[model samples]
Target: MADGQDLMERIGRLRPAVRAAGQPLHRPLLLLWAIAQAVHGRPRQQPWSVVKHELAPLLTQFDGAQRGERDVVYPFWALQRDGLWEVADSAELPLTSGGRRPTFAILEQVNPLAGLPEADYNRLIDDSTVAADALSTLLVRFFGANSGSVVEALRLREFVRGPIGASLLPLVGEQYADRKKIAEAYGGNGVMGITPLADGILAVYSDDKGPYPDHHIPETGWIAYTGDGLSGDQTLTVGNKSMQEYQKQEKALRYWHKPYNGSWTFETWAVVIQCRRRWGRGEDKKQRREYVWVLAPVPSPLRETWPSDVVEALAQDDKSVHDDSVDVIPAEVVAGQESRKLSAQERYQQLSDAARRTDGNRTNRSKPTLVERYMRSAAAREAVIIRSEGRCENPACGGHPLERTDSGQPLLEVDHVNGLARTGQDTPEFMIALCPNCHALKTRGAGRGELQKSLVPVARKLHRAMQRGERRKARPDGT
Candidate 1:
């Protein structure tokens, strides 16, 4: 029994060499060394890319060699070409004895590392294997760290360890910055958190922090509030009402409420910030504006770390965990599904059914009917109009408030500032963009005279006030 156990242990020790012998020889020197090693009864030719992929995390510690570089192929190929063992055709290069694959019975004779003391040999194998496994896992997880929130990705980085953990921090940080860049790309009138500072500078907070009804302005272009003690205040206000009136507006907007209250959540705030910056009027240029809203306390609990299982699972499959934490629900409920039991067959069937349903939904039985196409085209037109801020081309009515008419197919209709039918010109300058309400009122000759009289004076007054307001504020650097 003792001899048999010893023999089993010896065979187990030869596994790494056996596995290494089957890899491809890529680099010239390494390939030559591996081939020589194989000829001289040493394991040779493990897949070079596979080994490097496994070692990437640890190899990052070495100078000048990044994880997943082609340079790693040279060393691996050299090992095979050194003639440690004869390479035979197989998934792995098998040990050759008189042109035939050898059995496990000859394990000791074919292994060069096998001559080392058992303890040392085992330790080396264990360390290398651990490093390789860690790197491979990290590379997988690195690609999966695309959370919408920086905090989520940071939490994920903390749960990961060794090479994977190191790789994730920078990758996740880049992702976070990319999200900020995207938000900034939206430019003007983006959703911003405005904290009133006693100083001349406005403390513009990014919408990435949490949900609020206000627009998020970029910190880079914003006037830095130089007022003493202003930096300490991080809170901001939202909406057009006074503080008391805003408070009664319900937690639906403050905390994300589902269904009816889609715009009232943190995610919505992030999206709004992105949208306003990208598509808001005067967003591309610098301007001064005053906004008001009551600052409310954040209701959700702060997460200290990302769930370990989530981080681990996401590293393997990113899309699976994309919306994991976006929902406003208790973490305990989210965790329930992880512990649930389902047989392999049942899980397969469930996934398969989901795929079939998704495919069925995408199938088009007929060309989109004329009405359907019109509705789709109308929706696309509305999106374009919104993106353009519905600015009227007609100088006379450029700033007039516009509205949508059809609830389901709201189309933007412009009325002639100088009546088109009356004026008889095809020029865009004669047309004024009007909201559905204003367009209907103008077309039907209801309140058309009143609206025309009211808008001109209002527009003039607002323009003068904006100009005066812009001049009154002290510019940064006191210039």
Candidate 2:
């Protein structure tokens, strides 16, 4: 157990390992969640099953600095380093070949309990003044005035003196003076369509009357912005690639909108969850493939209301990017190296084999500092949709929603059964195809847990049937 004063100091200075990743609230949020549980006189340690379900939503709700994917495993595991927390049977937990912290899946496999150190838990329980001071420190130092309903939500209202004050982040619906002011404060290009700011922050500018009109989804808390590149085909490069980087890093994109002849207003913080290619006329009046990106607004001081489905979408999309030790070959990496035409099934097999191997963790004496990033497989997505037989896999939604995308593809979302973070597998066995309505219910609706458990077996059985050469049920077109 750590000394009480030292523990409090560590909590105050809580920060992300990579400082340039921006001031992430993962660790702080996890700590607060633990504290809240302790305040309620719950056990000092709790199972990962409970933590993942409860703590993850809290992280998503509060840590709005990042738009996609909250690092639930990192804060839960890394907190032990700060000496304020501990994990039961931690010594028995499996690690990667590099001996680093294992992925969320491995942790779930272990199911080891974790929480505040026994001494710390007792201290908080024994002394109300100490607990109040600690809660105050977290709310003020980390959350600031944006602690919207957090105190009440966490049942820490008795400790808080009066209502938490103003938010530090730019407020939504507030008019900013001009572009120059926003750039000065956030440190991004004032003129470019996409500016990569310091600390992995992304700033995107949209104009109501520009060549690309960014449209809002009525009452949906979402925005549809065309990808950067006003002339010719918009290849994934420059500003467009920067948007992908923000999505890859799970950071929010600060959006600023300029109405025709109106002062530039700070819009909302959003995550690039879905992107599709479509034919459109650029500024040059030539038809070409333009990328349309769907931005999901997360809960932040800038925004007040959030659609339940949008919230579910954010949580689901965020899990697509996991920092597990598993090795996944990106499409770019494979495309750069391979010359042969591999079928989608072959590609799926190859990628799954690569993910199952631990060579990525082996020591590279020559290039010891090489970094590996995981990318989802296109083949896996295609395979699941085809296997779904044009129906929702939920078994309750009846069939796929009677909606077709602009490209004529069935409007179905391919979701992982156990989450990519838990399994680190993008293969069909670990995934399922669902209509938008079913997908939302699986993520945030009541009885989501039962729904999740039911889908795991459904996905596995479907994959087995596919492997046995079952004939795929065709769509109504019969093509």
Candidate 3:
């Protein structure tokens, strides 16, 4: 069995689902927030703004993408695939603007809450072994041989210089403002994270008329990608109709696109879109912005006609490239899935792991696994009582916190109304608080089947009431 230190490294080395060399700075930035959160005395449930403001500087400093601020968008959506964080929203994913992702601004408007898992969140604060291992894993996995400068830039210097940086105190004041540069700049001289595209890449937007290659940019100018594609068109305004009408535009934008005369026979690409609204009446009010994409036919040929700045960036390799082999990613980080029956300890870990993931909603499928359906925790059960206000939800038995425990606490048991043992979900909707007698009648009584059937309406009523109460709080005076 792996020891504590080895497991810590394993957790830190967990990679985000992205392209081989794509730089997803959100992972490291999110990790930093988790660490700093422990250093401070902040709670595990963090609002979107906390991660947003704290992570901005890190994004600006180290994000290798064309626009660093846009980095928050993917983490809000994509980081859910990794098992270390979770979002409060469990609904199906929202629609995208064409194939392009929503910017940071849009995500803030849409998402209400997100955070690290409660167990992991609490552990990183209290456990030095875990924290140190996480730090080491992130450093070695991303920075490899060059973890020192990154440590300084990320404001982990004091911690890094310590015998074991994981024991460093909670950071105070402008935590992300160390202002140190990383060994590599995004898309500039970064040998790792970003894979540089050679000049002369060509992609085409295919119509019945065949591929529409960009022979030259129109007078309006355009944004260039390392691949053969363009950014949102700047010349036109967003949404020609009301804001809702833009949905139709996105569907229209999804026409067939193919690589023109490229080694890869076919290509799959996505379009990014946006809307620019101005104050006006009727049709004059909206302008729809479109960012269409196409794949490149060749890798290193389109140099001459490329934008001057892109050409210049592609040529700025004056500095010696660093060795990426030293980064030391563990083998399991790249392995495909293998399954086995989870032991009781593994069950608890999976529950914690699932809680922290941004995309942790495995039960939304038609036939979710038995384990996936039953991953609940002590906190989750307690939340049911709090949400239920400690009343027996059985309509036939209106039991409150009448019985007192030996500890002088209310005697109530949190029961899975639909029975997780029968493959029911362990979510808030399926849990209810019950007094001892009512609980037995519902779970083990000879008439339990009929009793459970009767309890469904009561459970749903309580769920709806709690939901309404939350909705009111979300909007004061029903505004």
Candidate 4:
């Protein structure tokens, strides 16, 4: 029988997938949900049918970036790896040929019961002190300053220790002569954009005149800050590390803005609500990896005055990290910006030249935002759509549906042949246009890898055919 300390240690050592896509919370969240169930004296074991129904909403609320039924399936089955969970009818359970858990549909049919083992459940239920210790370990380790909100959300207030929410610095906006003056006021080096100040406050400087220009989304009161690094792709170190740490801890950021011609002015309190890895041109006028942090502006006066939505978003453990480099631009926005028509061959040449120049050694030292990536890849996406000519590019796909978009164009999604995760080049030769159904299947289907493999040659062939002024209308019967 594992004691409370043992359980706390296990919770602390949870091995979530370490990827560029941010840490997955599926396991920790599942354990926390189980702890919540224990607090309410629920049964030790519950079927997947019941657990998914109850846990799906919590997962959706805390893990907003991940969607669909698959999210719930991972935690329910994967938690067993930590040795704290178990499943009934183990031999009877269905699994894939590789001895792994089957799809959620297959698991649903089996409906095996799973949860914390009997001994662990009994310990958590019988001893309130042990349960509180375990809950505190999970909350502090995963939720940080947002633990209080998690407690409230899970109705675990009775099991938590210490006060919730860190004390924030007072609303003080001032003007500084230069970086040195700002550094003297704050604790970190004045030269860096993101710096650590006293009492866990982050000093973020946005210089409009510099290579990285910050953009403000007025609708959400969010600032999309292009992260620090001058020559090449940015890494998780130094100023960028501080930004990530503060984001995970849900600490407030002391923002300052430097206009093109004016002195540095302290802005307002902010928090890094979201962060994404995107391809941006660096100092050498080539595409390089960059981190774009979306900082949410906090209301002034006091933390108590913040709206409920702001508070809730700050409490999310995932922080909605977008790992892909592609910045999705609306089709309408692309059409509006690219009014000058270029032939298929001409558009392909432009993208090819851009790709060749940005071979990782150089990048354009401009502030790369959603608009920048859109302008660069708009031609690539359009060229692929044009090549498809109202037909699905997937050779195996049935005829595209009769549905048309609002503009009377065929409804299709442009996808990279190698996938964005693999850093697929955003060029006409490496892209394909697919109908909505085929696109979804390619993205999330079990055979997506096979499908992606099949599309690679197809995309190349189509681009060549289109260049020869050949229009290959897709067969209605998928011949």
The TM-score of predicted model 3 comes to 0.31
RMSD, every candidate, angstroms: 25.1, 21.0, 29.9, 22.0
Candidate 1, lDDT over the whole model: 0.28
**Tens digit of per-residue lDDT, candidate 3, span 354-419:** 332412454443211211222223334534554544345554564443566553445788777777
lDDT, candidates in the order shown: 0.28, 0.64, 0.41, 0.67
Compute each candidate's TM-score over C-alphas.
0.20, 0.35, 0.31, 0.38
Q: Model 1 segments beyond 4 Å from truth?
A: 1-396, 399-479
lDDT of 2 by residue, 1-479 (tens): 44445545566446454344445777878888888877889998999878877777777777753332335777778888877679888888887737867677787678789999888888888876567656755664455435656786787776544443123234556576676776565444667878743223456778877889577743344676788998887877888876765555444566778888887776776767655454456786555556666677665422234455654554555423232212333333345557875544555555455533423443431211111111224446656765665567665674446567654557899989877656655567888988998888888989788889999998888777766656545445442
- Candidate 2 clashing pairs, residues 3+ apart or interchain: none
Question: How do the residues 213-258 of candidate 4 rate in per-residue lDDT, one tens digit apiece?
Answer: 5788533556879888876878988788768876775656678888
Winning model by TM-score: 4
Highest lDDT against the true fold, candidate: 4
Per residue, candidate 1 scores C-alpha lDDT tens digits across 285-346 of: 22112222212222111111333332232233211111111211112222455576543233
The parts of candidate 2 lying over 4 Å away from their true place are 1-166, 196-200, 218-221, 245-251, 299-306, 315-479
What number of clashing residue pairs does each candidate have, in the order they appear? 56, 0, 22, 8
Count clashing residue pairs in model 2.
0
